[model samples]
Target: MSAQKVAVITGSGDGLGKGIAKRLAKDGFAIVLSDINPDTLKATAAEFQADGVNVASFQGNVAKREDQFALVQHAVDTFGRVDVFVNNAGIEDVMALEDVTEADFDRVFDVNVKSVLFGTQAAAAQMKKQGGGSVYKIINACSIAGHESYDLLGVYCASKHAVRSLTVTAAKELAKHQITVNAYCPGVAATKMWDRIDAEMGKYMNTQPGEAFEKFSAGILMGRPQVPEDVAALVHYLASEDSDYMTGQALLIDGGMVFR
Candidate 1:
């Protein structure tokens, strides 16, 4: 309703989500940053405020439909319209096929697959009512482990493959309503989630974090790792007019690692 465009980004407390929010803000969208972590949410919101970017903050778990619904609600209430919704809040639990626990699988699916489903649904409803807007999901490069397989990361791979499928399906279903659904698949980016996981895994495996991070980036075609901002740029393009004609596609932003 406001003249300025509005963008609601989840997991925006840090890393990929924060980067996407920042980029979209620069692209002229008022930002609503959401995350389950309250301190981080406040901190991230402060960033946009300091830069004089129109911004708001909310704390909620993406997996909860009620919470997810409130996310959009707050943005609309604060900004008066929702022009873009970036469902970037997701978690992955790296586990071996045989060692995968029930809790581990559920945790990954709840946020990565289920939350994405509902987040898109909620945003699409708003967009459909308002005529149209863009919905994007920032799914990490699961292609390597997804298309093929890497050791101890099977669950994460499968969850991302599910996300890939979901993105295209939503795109096709929502296109008729003038809403576009797309995904940015980043290859081993330096997000907070990845950093924490790398540190934990490195300690467990008796390897340096650099060694682990290097091995992760080795699979990419560029052989150089990705930073959060790299993925954010693609997210910006996907959420903008330039990509209006593009929908139902998972655009790989993974430094060419997953391409055949």
Candidate 2:
């Protein structure tokens, strides 16, 4: 195994995932970035390489069990050992709870919940092989929706709630293996997800674009919108030895939006 830690981050081609990959790379990990979008994956890999960071890119859908396994194996193949796995690839579906189709529910759940489950399983298997010790971390991408159910975001909320549950259960089960499982619950980061959310909620609420996002941001005690870097900082902690003792916890990194 290589001396430097290896981190495999899903959906890291852009948005919060990209930020997490960058921050972790800055902290000296050899990064393996994955995304379903091949173009985005190539672009992010190039950007990281330009900054003198060691990075490899893979294009795979996070919702597939086979793909999840491939991501972990790719890390091991390229970097020798896997130290961190970030299940950050997720999508949002903003529809009225009443109007939500079974298909929509399955898609959202598959990407947000199922991906984390299998992704964690895949990573843990490798971490255990690397000596069944707390030398590895599994971080899930949760959201404020996981904490509180919102109107149009019900399905998305449910999916994240499942993520939170999985994080706890995986932490407990993987503890003997010395693997830490945790999640970062971000509120309203100004990413493309929120931009799409703003537009979709506008359609449901009969409001203008940006209004829903503004309203949510207005409620933050910090009085400002969260950037991707805010979430990345929390991830940096979770991925480091500083958080070795922390697991099974879904930390709220949302500008004080929901106090736990």
Candidate 3:
């Protein structure tokens, strides 16, 4: 077993997940990157390697329970132990509530909710097996939508709400094992996911591309759009010893979007 700590971040091929992985790597944790997209995952692993990061990459669908388990196993196989597991893989559905079909509900919930639940289970089991004094962290990726619902993102919001619930329940259950489960909720961000949201929302709102994103950004009290670093900073805190006493909380890192 290696001496350095290990962290497994799902959907780390791009965007916020990638940023979090980089930040943790800089903090001296060996990183295991997982993504459903093989190309992006390979590229990201290469980039991290070039940057002198102790990294491994796994390609898997996070929505599957088996895949989530396999991701944790990969971390253990490559590194010594898993100290932090971030369930950061999620999908956003941009559609009116009336147009949300069963398929849409399943698609959103499977990736956003099911993945977090099973991912925490897998990480906690490994942490229990290790049985050291070290704190094991399970950080989930939630959204401001989890707190307040928007018009076209009802299903996505519901899925994130489920994430928050899972974080709280898992924290309560895993406290005995020294595993802390918490979530970071981000608002409007300058990422490819938000680009898609902006484009899809344009279709409904009858606005041009980038217009919807501008409108959403306008609501941010910080007077600036969110960056991946903003979210990564929060995740870094949750993963570090500084947040050892914090759990069961879905913290909003959205720059004053939802004030709850």
Candidate 4:
């Protein structure tokens, strides 16, 4: 049999990751699920299998190079080649500048930035061998914080800003090889991550999780706070042949927070 389009979505066993993986599978891209969560990893794979989509799973810590290497290598070994890579695994640290410990900052950078670097390196090596591919980094809804500042999320914003910078740099650096490196910065999406952020940062919405979620629909001019599937739809587009001409851009999927 000939090779099918294959995508490896890191941290894709649940939430946004799972949504992206399922979308890719539906789009006919063979889906390779990677996450630190082994049980969810297998469950996602089996679920896709039941749907008759080509699927597989790999468990790896995003902060580790060897793990990243294995995931890319497995993509090649199992599916012939990788056509897309999504770096979607991340964590948030909600402490002020002074309260943010070195260890905490390091941990955030390790997963958010370092992992993407190595993961991109691994994907690029393979993509280069196979001609080229696309890489998408799913950055959180960093609020105005990514560009400005929030009360207790300096570290988280810093980490995302780092990812944003790295993405632009990679776009320019990788263009020559036909590898498109880009990031999707979605504003506040109602997910587990958002729930955690809300709990730590206090009532940004003045309501509980569900209540707050509905209240904070949009910032000034932005449409609304997003859902995982909302971001997933855009990710689906970027991973396809339709976005071949796009590269080296930080496409903001947020409701207009940054421009405001």
Highest lDDT, which number? Answer: 3
List lDDT for all candidates, in order: 0.77, 0.93, 0.94, 0.76
Candidate 1 least-lDDT 10 residues: 134-143
Clashing pairs in model 3, backbone N/Cα/C closer than 3 A: none
TM-score of each: 0.91, 0.98, 0.99, 0.88
Tens digit per residue, CA lDDT, model 1, 141-190: 22334444556667877888887788788877877777777777777876
**Model 3 — TM-score against the truth?**
0.99
Model 4: lDDT equals 0.76
> Ten residues in a row with the worst lDDT in model 4?
134-143
Model 2, 1-260: lDDT tens digits are 78899999999999999999999999999999999998888898999999999998889988999999998898898998999999999999999888989899999999999899989989999999998344589999999988999989999999999999999999999988889999999998899989999999999899898999999899898889899899999999999999999999999999988988
- Candidate 1: global Cα-lDDT? 0.77
Off by over 4 Å in 4: 132-145, 203-224
Report how far residue 37 has shifted in candidate 3, in Å: 0.4
True lDDT of residue 208, candidate 4 = 59
lDDT of 4 by residue, 158-240 (tens): 88788777777877888788878777777777778778776765644354546544544545255667777878888887787
Quality of model 3 by C-alpha lDDT: 0.94
Model 2 — TM-score against the truth? 0.98
Which run of 10 residues does model 2 get worst, by summed lDDT?
127-136
Ranking by TM-score: 3, 2, 1, 4
